[model samples]
Target chain A: MSSKKLFLIGLLVSFLVAGFFSFYSSSQPDGLQKATAEQGLDLTVVDSANADSSLANYGVAGIENERLSGFLGGAIGVAVVGIAGTGIYFWVRTPKSGETK
Target chain B: MHMPDGLINAQVSIGAAVIAAGAITVGLKKSKGTLDSQTAPLAGLVAVFIFAFQMMNFPVAAGTSGHLMGGALASILVGPYVAILVMTVVVSLQALVFADGGLSALGLNLLNMGIVSIVVSTILFAGLMKLLPKTRISIIGVSATVAFISVLASAGAFVFEYSLGGNATYNIASVLISVMSVHVLIGIGEAIITGLTIGAILATRADLVYGARKFLPAHNLLIKESVVA
Candidate 1:
C-alpha cells in the first residue's frame, strides 16, 4: 500500500483501538487515583468549575444509560482530538512553495 | 494521566485548557518556519508508534496495569513541538473515541501528559545532550535517563494540579510522595523502551530519527570511511 494509504489506515486503527479500550476501561480509579485514595489524598480533590457541564461527568444528564453515555463520550473525544490535532499539525507543517520537495 | 471529567476543579481545568492552547499555538508557529517534508511524516509515524505502545500496558501491581506515556519518547525522537502534537493526537483520541479520559478533562490531560512531558523532557534531553559526547550510545543513554526524569516531572505536575483542584482533604505531601514513588518505577520502564526504540531507529535510519540527528553526520561519515577502507 502507498504511504498515504498506510498512514490513513494507521490513523483509523488507532481510533478504533482507542475506542475499544475506552469502552472497556475499568470503572475503578487509575493507578495514581488509587494511590491517592490509599494515601488519604482523595478527599482533598475538588470539583471542577464546569462541574455542571454536559460532558463533565461523561454523561448527558437524564440519559440513564451508562453504556450509551460512555459511547457518546468516547465518540466526542475522538472527534475533538482528531480534528484539533490534525488541524494543528497541518497548519504547522504546511510547506511554502519554495520549500516544497 | 488521562484525568476523567469532574476530577479537577473547573478553574484549574479552564486554566490548563488555556495553557495547552497557548503551547499548541506556539508549537504551530515554530513548526511553520522550520518544518520540512522529511520531518512531518516522521512526526505522524511517531504518533502511531506511541499509540500502539500505549496499548501494551505493563502490570503496575497486583491488579492494575500502567502504560507508556510517550511524551519523553516522542520529544527525544522528534522535536518537542511535534512531540506535543503527537501526544495531543493520542490523548484526544483516547478521550473522545475510547472514553479513556473524560471529555471535560481534555485540557488537563493535554497539559499533564502532552505539554509537560514532551516540552519539559525535550528541554532536559537537549540540555543533557549538549554536555554529552555526540555518539549514538550517548544519545541513547541521555534520552533514556531524561525520559525517566520527564515522567517524574509529569507526576509532579499532576500532584500540583490535584492539590489545586482536588476534592479531597488529604495532605499534599502525602499525595506528592505517593505519586512520585510509583512514577519513579514507571519512569524506569519508560526509559528502557525509549532507549531501545531510539537506538533501533538510529541504527537503521538515523536520517528519519529526529533526536538522533546530532549523531547522524559523525555516524554517517564513519560508515562512509569504513566503506572506503
Candidate 2:
C-alpha cells in the first residue's frame, strides 16, 4: 500500500479509538491509582495546576452531556497531537539531498 | 503511569525535570541525524496513536485498569531517539492540555514513561535482534518481551522515586510489591498490543518498521527455504 493510504488509515484508526471507542473504556482507576489507593496513599490529593482547564480529566468543563464532552475533548486531543507531532517531526527531519537547511 | 501531584516531593520532581530536559536535548540531536521524510511521518503517527490508545483504559483486574504506554512499539517503528520525541509530545500534551498528569510531576512522568521505557526497550531490542534469528516472528517476539519488561521497568522507576520522596510513609517493600504486581498484568496487555502491531506492520510494510527492516531480507530468505521444503 501507498504511504499516504497507510497514513490516512492510521489517522482514521486513531480518531475512532479516541473519539468513539473511548466511551466504552473501563471507568475503574488505572494501575497506579489502584496501587496507591490500596496503600492508602491518595495521589490526587493535590489538584493539578491545570485542573480547571476546560479539557481537564479528558472532558470539556462546561459540557453537561458526558458522551458529548468526552467525544469533543478526545477529538480535540487527536487534532492537537497530530498537528504538534507532525510539525515537530517536519522541523527536525533531515533535509533531502538537494535541499539545504 | 501518569503520576499526580503530591505523590513525589518538589525536590525530586525538579531534579527529574532537569534530567528529563537533558535527555530530550540529546534525543533531538540524535533524531536529527536519524529521521528523514520517510520516517518522520511514521514517528508523528506513532505519537498520535499512542495518545489515542492511552485514553482507552482496559480493565486489567476487578478494580484496576491499564492502557498502552507505547514506548516499545514506537521505538520499534521509529528509532529510539524519535520514539523519545514522540512520547515526550504525547505525555506533555496529556499533562498540559488534558490535565491527566500533574504539572509538577510532568518530569517524573516523562522520565519513567518516556526515558526509562524507551532506553530499556532499545537496549533489550538491540541485544535480542543480535542474538535471535532475523525473522518477522523473532522481531515480534523481541517486541513483546521488551514491551513487557519496559512496563515493569517504568513501574520500578516510580517505586524508586516514591521511596526517595513519597509523601506517605508506606513500607517500601509493600510499595514495590503493589506497584510491580499491578504492572505485571499491565505489562502483559502492553506486550500483546506491541507484538500484534509490529507483526502487522512487518507483514505489510516491513520497510517502514525500524526494528524489522534489517531482518526482512533474512525473513524472505527463510520463506524461500521453506518453499523448497
Candidate 3:
C-alpha cells in the first residue's frame, strides 16, 4: 500500500476510535485508580500538572457537549501525537549516510 | 498502568525517569538502524492506533476498567527499539496533554508502561517466536500469550516501584496481591486486542509488519505454491 493510503487509514481509524467510539468507553476509574482507592492509597495521588488543559481527561475543557468534547479531544490527541511523534522520529532518526532531515 | 503523581516519593519518580531516559537514549540509537524513511510513518501510526485504543477502556472488574497497553502489540508491529520509542511518545502525550497521568510521575509511568512492558514483551516474544512455527496463526498465538504476560510484568513493575517509593503505608503483601489480580484480567484483554489487531494487519499488509518481515518473502512464495497446488 502507498504510504499516503496507510497514513490516511491510520488517521481514519484514529478519528473513528477516539472521536466517535470514545463515547462508549468505560467511565469508571481504571484498574490502578480503583485499586488505589480501595487499597487506601488514594490519598497519595497528586493532581496532574495538565489537569487544567483544555483536552484533559480526553475531553475538551470548555465544550458543553460531552461527546463533542471527547470527539475534539480525541482528534487533537491524534494530531498532536502524530505530528510530534513522527517529527521527533525524523529529527533524531539516524540520517542515511548521505541524507539530511 | 499510568501511575499518577503523589503515589510515589519524588526521589523515586525522578530515579525511574532517569532510568527511563537512559533506556530511551539507547532506543534512539538502536532504532535508528530499523527506522529509515520507509518505517518512520508506520511507527507513528502505531502510536496513534495504540493511543486511540487506550481511549476506549473496557470494564475488567467491579469499578475497575482496563485499556490496551499496546507494549507487546507495538513490539510486534515495530521492532522493540521503535516500540519503546512509540510507547514513550504515547505516555508522554497522555501526561502532558490529556492529564491522564501525572506529570511528576511521568518517569515511573514511562518506566512501567514504556520500558518495562516493552523490554519484557520484546524478550518474551523474541524467545517464543523462535520456538513457534513461522505460520501467521502461530505467530499470533505466541504474540497474544506473550502480550498477556507482558501486561502482568508491567503490573509487577508497578508493585515494585510502589514498594520502593510509594507514599501509601499499605502492606507490601496486600499491595502485590491487589495489583497482580486485577492486572491478570486486564492482561487477558490486552492479549485479545494484541492478537486481533496483529492478525488483522498481517492479513492485509504482511509486508509492512516488522516482526513478520523476516517471514514474509517465504510466506508469499508459499502462498503462490499453495495456490498452484
Candidate 4:
C-alpha cells in the first residue's frame, strides 16, 4: 500500500480504537492501584504536585460528563501520539546532508 | 504499562529519562548505520501494526484488560537495535500525544517497557533460537516463551523501581507477586498473539521477516528443488 494510504488507514483505525478504549475503560483500579488498595497502602500514596492539572485526571476542567471527558482525552491522546510519533520517525529516519539514501 | 504522572517519584522518573534518552541516541546511530532503504519502511509498517495490535486489549482476570506490549514482536520481526528505536517511538508518542503515560515519567516508561523488554527479550530469544532447531514452529515457540518471560521481567523491574520510590507501604513481596502473576497470564496472551502474527507473516512473505533468516535457506532450497522438478 502507498504510504499515504497506510497512514490514513492507521489513523482511522487508531481513532476508532481510541474511542472504544476511552468509552469502555474500566473505572476499577489497575493492577498497581488494586494491589495497593488491597494491601491498605493506597492511603499513603500521595498525588504529585501537578495532580491539580486538568489533564492529570484525563479530564478537562468543568467537564461534568465523565464519558465526554474520557472521549476527549482519548481523542487528544491519539492525535498527540500519532503526530508526534510520525514526526519523530521522519526526523530520525531522514538522511543527513552528506548521507546517501 | 503507561505509568501516569505522579505514579513514580520525580527523581526516579528523571533518572529513567536520561537512560532512555541514551538508549535512543545509541539506537538512532545504530539504525542509521545498519538500516537499509528496504528495512526502514518495513520498520515503520511494523510500528503501525504494533500500534494497531496494542489497541486490541484482551480480558485479563476478572475485569482488568491487558494489551500487547509488542516489545518481543518488534525485536523478533526487526533487529534489536531497530526494535528498540521503534518501541521508543511508540512509547514516546503514547506519552506525549495521548498523555497515556505521564510526560515526566516518559523516561521510566521507556526503560521499563521499551528498553528492558525489547532489549532483554531479543537477546534471550536469539540465544534460545541458537539452541533450538531453526524450524518455523520452533521459532514461534521460542518467540512466545521469550515474550512471556520478558513481560514478567518487566513487571519485576517495575516492582524494583517502585520499592525505591514507592509512596505506598505495601508489602514488597505481595506487590511483586501480584504484578508478576498478573503479567505472567498477560504475557501468555501476548505470546500467542505475537506468535500467530509472526507465523502468518512468515507464511506469506518470509523474506520480510527479519528473524526468519535461519529458515530462509531451507525454504529457498525447497523452492529451487521444486523449480528443477
Candidate 2 off by > 4 Å: A98-101, B218-229
DockQ of each: 0.21, 0.68, 0.59, 0.24
- Point out the higher-scoring one by lDDT: 1 or 4: 1
Model 1 over residues B1-229: C-alpha lDDT tens digits? 5676666778998999999989877776676634555455556666666765565456565555556788998887668877777787887766654555666778988998899998788788878888988888898898899888888888899889988987556678888887887778778888888898788667666755667665566656446635665
lDDT of each: 0.70, 0.88, 0.84, 0.69
Q: Residue A89: error of model 2 in Å?
A: 2.2
**Candidate 4 C-alpha lDDT tens digits along A24-69:** 6454445445554565655654444455666544555578887787
State the number of backbone clashes in model 1: 23
Compose the digit string of candidate 2's lDDT tens values, residues A1-101: 76677888888999999998999989899999999888877743599988999999888898999999989988999999999888667856677873322
Off by over 4 Å in 3: A1-3, A88-101, B219-229
lDDT of 2 by residue, B169-188 (tens): 68889989999999999999
Q: What is the C-alpha lDDT profile of model 3 across B23-130, one tens digit per residue?
A: 999988888745556556778888889999999999999889999999889888888888888998999999998998899999898888888888898788778878
Which tens-of-lDDT digit does each residue in B92-177 have in candidate 4? Answer: 76654445566777888899888999878878987898898888888888888988887887778888888888765567888788
Top-DockQ candidate index: 2
For model 4, report the TM-score of its A chain.
0.74
Stretches of candidate 4 above 4 Å error? A1-29, A40-101, B218-229
Pairs in clash, predicted candidate 2: none
